[model samples]
Target: MFVSRLLDFQKTRYARFMNHRVPSNCRYQPTEYEHAANCATHAFWILPSILGSSILYILSDDQWETISAWIYGFGLSSLFIVSTIFHTISWKKRHLRTVEHCLHMFDRMVIYFFIAASYAPWLNLRELGPWASHMRWIIWIMASVGTVYVFFFHERSFGGRDAGAGMREQGRAAMTCFFHMVAPNGKQKAPGVSPKPQTPDSELAAPRPG
Candidate 1:
């Protein structure tokens, strides 16, 4: 039957894609199926994320709100956009080591900005007491420091394996602080107003060893 022939063809293609060997210089290389899935997952969300951010920006009632909206929107869109491009390149142009390496670093860097942006609306809009008020500036400073660290010391200071664990711990600590401040009274404050933190699955996608 035609359906049987189609299934056999698919199996052949899958085997061919999966049989490719990981390059020696790369820490990890995804199978073709993984590359395609990662690219699709992030690409699919790009437009919706942008549209949602635009809606939030339009709904803002004041200057501070508008600024927060803009920050959050840019962060949200860039996260998806950069992720999609990176994965697409990874899948389609794996041979371009230099270009892939640069994008891989950039992809990692965007997560810090996204974290700060996720908290922007809440930190700017709510009153979290005098001590907590400083968190608004503190979060950004932390993000900036994180960016610099990723740029200069990511895989350089520690070997590739440990560096990832350290980055994850740092991200976890940052989120923990954000949640603690957001809910000092032990109740969710903003409900639908504040965007929930996002962890892109592509964050774990393998990068070439530099």
Candidate 2:
């Protein structure tokens, strides 16, 4: 009888999960279990991300490389940490509106920094022409502008937007970064000269002296 009752409960929980629908408005009030699950998604990665960042920092060969690694590491780890904290608070302390709102704002702000840091290693470590070099600094400037926008205008601008608008914003940002990263550097190889093959690691590693 106990086993049968447990099976029925499991079926009911599964049904609720399957029937869940996202509201039209941007405000999503997840159930306690959903909030815990969301928190776990980011919290579980915090340790591994930190360990990976530490490894990259230790593997860095120069001062600039170390700095890039540190930037990337901080961005990656902070994203997860902040997300975990925010979601945990949302789950465990739903009544704390003021604290939750502050954390929520911080959570959004960190994402811009994280995006810029993701590009840092590749931009700083790779050998590039003048255009790409300029982008190295430009990306940070863009991130700063984005962070400022989020801080000063996010609530006022996007507080009433629907889920689709939020998705479109994310898509636009991703496309912008993609084009910047893949844009031509205006360098042409000599006739009959083969370019060196590039691996993922090579793209992020500091350029070796020729």
The estimated TM-scores of all candidates read 0.68, 0.67
Tens digits of lDDT, candidate 1, 33-87: 7888899899999999989989998898777778888999999999999999999
Candidate 2 lDDT, 1-210, residue by residue in tens: 878777664367466543345555346577666787889899999999999999999997677678888999999999999999999998889799999998988888788778778877766665545455576677767667666766675555456753235434543554444334432545443222346777788567868779
Worst 10 residues of 1 by lDDT: 183-192
Lowest-sum lDDT 10-residue window in model 2? 183-192
CA shift at 45, candidate 2, in angstroms?
0.9
Model 1 off-target regions past 4 Å?
A: 1-26, 156-210
Question: Could you say which candidate leads in TM-score?
Answer: 1
Q: Please report how far candidate 2 places residue 156 from its true position, in Å.
A: 5.1
Give the lDDT of residue 16 in candidate 1: 51
